[model samples]
Target chain A: LFAATTVMADPLPSWSDTEVKSGIVAFVETVTDPASDDYVTPSDRIAVFDNDGTLWGEQPVYFQFIFAIDRLKTLAEADPSVLSSDVLTAAAAGDMETVLAGGHDALFEILNATHSGMTVDAFQQEVAQWLEDTKHPDTGLPYDEMTYQPMVELLRYLRDEGFKTYIVSGGGIHFMRVFAQEAYGIPPEQVLGTYTNTEYAMVDGEPVISKVPGIAFVDDKEGKPINIERTIGRRPIFAGGNSDGDFAMLEWTTAGKGPRFGLLVHHTDGDREYAYDRESPIGRLVDGLDKGPGLGWTIVDMKQDWQRIYTGQN
Target chain B: LFAATTVMADPLPSWSDTEVKSGIVAFVETVTDPASDDYVTPSDRIAVFDNDGTLWGEQPVYFQFIFAIDRLKTLAEADPSVLSSDVLTAAAAGDMETVLAGGHDALFEILNATHSGMTVDAFQQEVAQWLEDTKHPDTGLPYDEMTYQPMVELLRYLRDEGFKTYIVSGGGIHFMRVFAQEAYGIPPEQVLGTYTNTEYAMVDGEPVISKVPGIAFVDDKEGKPINIERTIGRRPIFAGGNSDGDFAMLEWTTAGKGPRFGLLVHHTDGDREYAYDRESPIGRLVDGLDKGPGLGWTIVDMKQDWQRIYTGQN
Candidate 1:
């Protein structure tokens, strides 16, 4: 009964009493214990989390893509030429079939057009306003509220134990900066992701940084590790991800010479949330799930492991 | 006597009783005082410092360029054909006159050839080993040991007030990361600078990030603010710098809507260190000095402001 009570008090409250949960608890304990040989210093305790499917609902396409489509519509109303581009037209019409058929190049065009050419402040204000007014179509909850409750607990727990948590996502860096601190307690400086090129210029006697229409970097798959190296300069001790897009980050992190933890949030709750793997077009998990055992990465079964998904908090 | 005792207890011991020193202290106090309207939350207290002349010595030439020249010499010994390239030959001969004669393009070629194509770990190991072995020719001290004592105290003071200090420089990001934590208390992750392109690949079933011979980004002049926005996603409240290279950073930082602080480290003690601003080949400070008063930037004169320069800690 005492053991059961203590287990209920686990740092990860939403996580059930499974090997996956215990693994996280044990890893944190060993690395944080001052007397332990595996103890990692506070400065060295960096944990990187993927923000999309891993932390929140990314189904039916990424939240950023939705924001981009909405932005395209707004721009088209003011300047109809924005809709002349095939990709922008397809995106505004909600035709995912056509949008995906054009592939990544088309995606880049749409993203660059929607995400750039504005003052940094104006872009941030627009993103903040959109987040405040919009909701997930399926959940009927504010997009920020769609964040996984278990992952939020994990982030807080790690920070409580002196780890610096960072969101290394594929979303636009500035897009995440809008609500990341309010929603996740991670600062803007700690959020690293795909970037739009920006230029500094004196406009009307005021210094302003304007976003240019191009991708500076893409933080996905193999790009994750490279971007991490470029920005963070230190390899993360803990890597949390949801799909094959994060496989390289986990691989690079776990390969480091130290006690490391790699977690893959497997979507297995079709009733509570959307269950997905392998065949999902958005964030496929085939390669990572197949090699999870070999890589010693914990495969978190959402249906069995999580007691709840969303906790009604931003 | 009481007033003198208070002066002795200054947070910046190396800085004399000057307006520049008082400006820093007053700014910190107001922003940290909870009762003050100017009070900034600890999370928003981001401070960025330039590396070369701001933190350490950059006398004869920038230190990283010296490192590149040394690397070229070593590489040329192994492969004589390395010297066949005009830039490589000039660099290996320690002929700065000839190297600079070829201009910025030649400089980039030399930097790329010397700084890329190795595994990340190997490059870090080489840098670490070089820092351990080499010393500055003029100072007869390890390059890291040549860091300004006044700036180090300022860093500690800011951190003591809950400010997160970051090194924002035009120097090679990886090169600075090798000794940044040891030389100054700033960690690698907190340091932002110019970067070499990198790629993640599986070598012998092990993941490795290899540096590619290309300029990914240059954190100089106009590039500073853009890169800062991309990586940090925050507009810094305090920006410290030493040359025209840091002009854009200072401009962007001071232009923010707040009680912002901008500092320029002006080297004026040629006897103690080296001082050749404006027309100096390295770390020129002309436009910044002319615009300093208008921007309300605090200029620290090494001759009059600092009681001591290098403390030889690193």
Candidate 2:
């Protein structure tokens, strides 16, 4: 009697048979094989991914920006003084251009006013409540549900291959910790992102951590690599990003001495999902797109490389 | 036929049969046993330890201060201009009071001058070199070898019981990352501590993360709990610290909804290791010691509880 071995299907089923998928698979196979020269130990097999556009849909504007807008509207309705903030004023008028022009400093100011002076548990509750209650204006799906199907598969695939997946995003650490585990299977400890200062205090005879105003660090652009080093203390073997914000992360990962992989998820599917690259103010994929090829980076074209835009939306 | 069962000995061999050891064992057993009401799943069984005094000897001064002093002396010898910094001058001259008077701001300034401007790899190498070459002033043992034997056994014991051990220290994050794994079996990612700013850059066509001299975050006092929340996301079930710097961490851990353990390692073995506390300028243990019994926090008296000090010295 002959016995047949159990066979497994493709790990990244949502991804098309494109060079991007092949590159990722090849890198994983090579580094994970015991006999391969580039084989890495399980503990050192770290894969970092940017959260905004790379993991989920960040079209029209970042979801965090939308959260800020919702928060601003509520604050304006309660306290008329909120209408005086420049960014909030632009947001209240429903003008995207003016709000975009205000840059990150304005975003920090808005976050400081709305997100700070509250207990972290309170802020976490607010984020969780908003994520569960609000829907993405464009997709009409919950913000957490808008995560990329192919990328989600990739995250799981990497973990299956002995990689510790981490989300190193420009998003607020506190904000992402609320749903990161539920949405992506990445725990709060593995999620390193932009952080605001917090202070521990005893309020009403109970210990509480209060979020302070002002940004402590921005985990975007060059800051991504810096924060990654500060938090993880090891160079990632695999790095994924969609925009210029992830450029330094990709560069740093690829430039490491041993076998490394850098993947750039180019949003090219306009019909299935929003597609804006190089020219888009939010999640701009300019310098990375232009310089990625020379750096041996895998550029994943979403329209051609991904068969499904999102989970359950295929 | 008679069968003789070889009974295993106590896991924490270095710890004596004192209340401290019994308390630790009881907490671990309760949380680990599935039948117990205090049972915690392995994934959520996180234990955080304060490094300087809690896990090791912090008598003469914090080991990090010793490192900084050594670094300052070398800099002053090489570049006389380094002596211009008041803190560095005081440190180089062996004036502990003047150097201590300068406080954390002065420490940051010295760290910035000596530790900053170098790539993280370079800094790690320097730290490793220092740990290898330098010996504790009075003990004549390698700095890494000066770690508390009882505490080391406790760490291993917890790990064996399925607890994820982490180091939350007031020392520099980079400094602790250098030898944490070797000394305590704690990986770099699990070691959270005071951090300085770092920037990612490409120099000589190679990517490098350059350490910047300003303070990014301090992991002391109120900062401990805040950093723990920021880094770990979940509240620790078990918290170990020696001084008031760890008071907030203990408070935060013990105040969590379910069963939790808080341990304060009181340095009472002056004959074995330095034991000044309460009135001591560094690693002061007054408030925590006074309030610990009422809080149901275990206070480990080193002189009475530990049968050994250092691993080999025993």
Q: Could you give the TM-score of chain B for each candidate, in order? A: 0.96, 0.96
Candidate 1 residue B215 C-alpha distance from true site, Å: 1.3
Span of ten consecutive residues with least summed lDDT in model 1 chain B: B1-10
Q: In model 1, where do residues sit more than 4 Å from their true spots?
A: A1-8, B1-8
Go through the candidates in order and give each one's DockQ.
0.88, 0.86
Query: Alpha-carbon interface RMSD of model 2?
Result: 0.9
Pairs clashing within candidate 2: B112-B213
Single out the weakest 10-residue window by summed lDDT for candidate 2 chain A.
Answer: A1-10
True contacts kept of 1: 1.00
What is candidate 2's CA lDDT for residue A177? 91
Residue range B46-151, candidate 2, lDDT tens digits: 9999999888878688888788778878877888897776677877889888867888677777777777878888888988999989988898899898888999
Give candidate 1's error at residue B286 in angstroms.
1.2
C-alpha TM-scores of all predictions: 0.96, 0.96
DockQ of 2: 0.86
Question: Each candidate: how many clashes?
Answer: 0, 1
Q: What is the lDDT of residue B128 in candidate 1?
A: 85
Reference-based lDDT, each prediction: 0.89, 0.87
Query: Compared with the true structure, what per-residue lDDT tens digits does model 1 show for residues A213-247?
Result: 88878899998988888888989999999999999
